[model samples]
Target: MSSRKSILEAIKAIPREEKPLPDLPDFGISGELEEGFTQSILGNKGEVLEKSVFENWLATQDFSKILSLTESYRNLSTIELPKDPHELSTLDLAILEGQFGVAENGAIWLDDSQLFLRAIPFITEHLVIVLDRKNLVPTLHQAYQRIGDAHSGFGLFVAGPSKTADIEQSLVIGAHGAKSLRVVWK
Candidate 1:
């Protein structure tokens, strides 16, 4: 058997916060999907509207070739990103638009820019999104600035799965939107 090291030695390696943390809203995912947090954002407004409003968004694109993924996004077919990212039907998830809102936490802002899906992300069932860390913000106030006054159409800010504690204060998830969320930062 290998020699065992004292448990106290391991704790010393961990880093501690240098400053006091600020109060904020809880938007992290919990429960079975507690460990999964992946998100994709498209750029611009025209692209965002086209994708959300039309089901045939990929009609002209060649979805007959790419394969699909198995993990959490099994529902999503492996659609290839266009050679020119601007080709509406080219991206697996085209981030064509975004409207910011106040976040109660030091986390980044959110809006319809990421969550307006009509179906599952993978064919197998369920979905997953690993957001880019650069998008993170310190508070919701900053999020509003990002939005400005561009209210072209519909939008929202989603935090984790749809959960409720109505039945005897018991928390339940997956009631309205996604079943899980996992926010991984760099």
Candidate 2:
């Protein structure tokens, strides 16, 4: 017998044991989901806002170059979605819809279907994600249960603004992506 065949036969002859999956601890913070989400987002250097607060904040800004994909804020949209992802490098602000938010880590789920250009959120100077308050989950386990395996080839859990501490342990926000992140809960 060839050496490779002999090795394969020996490997196949070995007994294997099946192990049960470990049970995840119940964080049990569902009742405080909103507070947990707010604290987590604040820890990640992101801001959480109510609809009225966000609207009031928006009113003070210059909307000349804002790009909004959500239907509710279409009136404030100034630029069209770029055909090329590279063209998004100059975006000042981008407002997109998030499918859900996780309270454990303050992450918002975004899939390819929700993003006109995959780079819009990352390329913009500021990113605003609009998510429904009812869609908040207490943990990543529950968040995954909600998403399942059905996705449009691409998905991401964005936690906050891009940051890097690579250089001399110095923190840098917006090092490679949006400088700030604001979550608008409706």
Candidate 3:
């Protein structure tokens, strides 16, 4: 079979809309958001945690080694992102300051300005997203209010770690994308 067919088969196999939204209308999503929204996409538990608790949790885990493995990781502090996405390394992760959030799927719409590597999200062993307490949204429908026609540049709404359950109905996380996602709210 062709690679495209194989990929399509995999995506189709995933259980569609298996997860449901929570009952509360407030849902703890933020309201003062405009362009580039992406929060409500995550899920209920996404909002239940305190920022302090989340930050404290990060201090407990070890990401130093993972950072060292990437060929261009150390150079990011001094390097500027190339305008082209093709220039990004497969293991680079960009910590961007999100402009707004998407409520429908708990995603954050970040501008390329804060990114160090253009394709950082697609080619990284780990991803760490940091957000301020001020930016959060309720639903994907609400997120659409922020996107304008000039979405000419690149953007993405990421939720949790990358995952796939393509084999034997198994539930696996971090298959093709980063093996882990570290979210910090301050």
Give the Cα error of residue 55 in candidate 1, in Å: 27
Candidate-wise lDDT, in order = 0.36, 0.89, 0.53
**CA shift of 51, model 2, Å:** 1.5
TM-score for each candidate, following the candidate numbering:
0.39, 0.93, 0.54
Q: Against the correct fold, how does model 2 do in TM-score? A: 0.93
Q: Count the backbone clashes (under 3 Å) in each candidate.
A: 26, 0, 19
Give the per-residue lDDT digits (tens) of candidate 1, residues 29-78: 34222122122221100111122323353345444433222232334455
Ranking by lDDT: 2, 3, 1
The candidate scoring highest on lDDT is: 2
CA lDDT of 17 in candidate 1? 75
Best by TM-score: 2
> Candidate 2's residue-wise lDDT over 9-39, tens digit each?
9999999998999999987566588899989
Specify the poorest-scoring 10-residue window by lDDT in model 1.
40-49
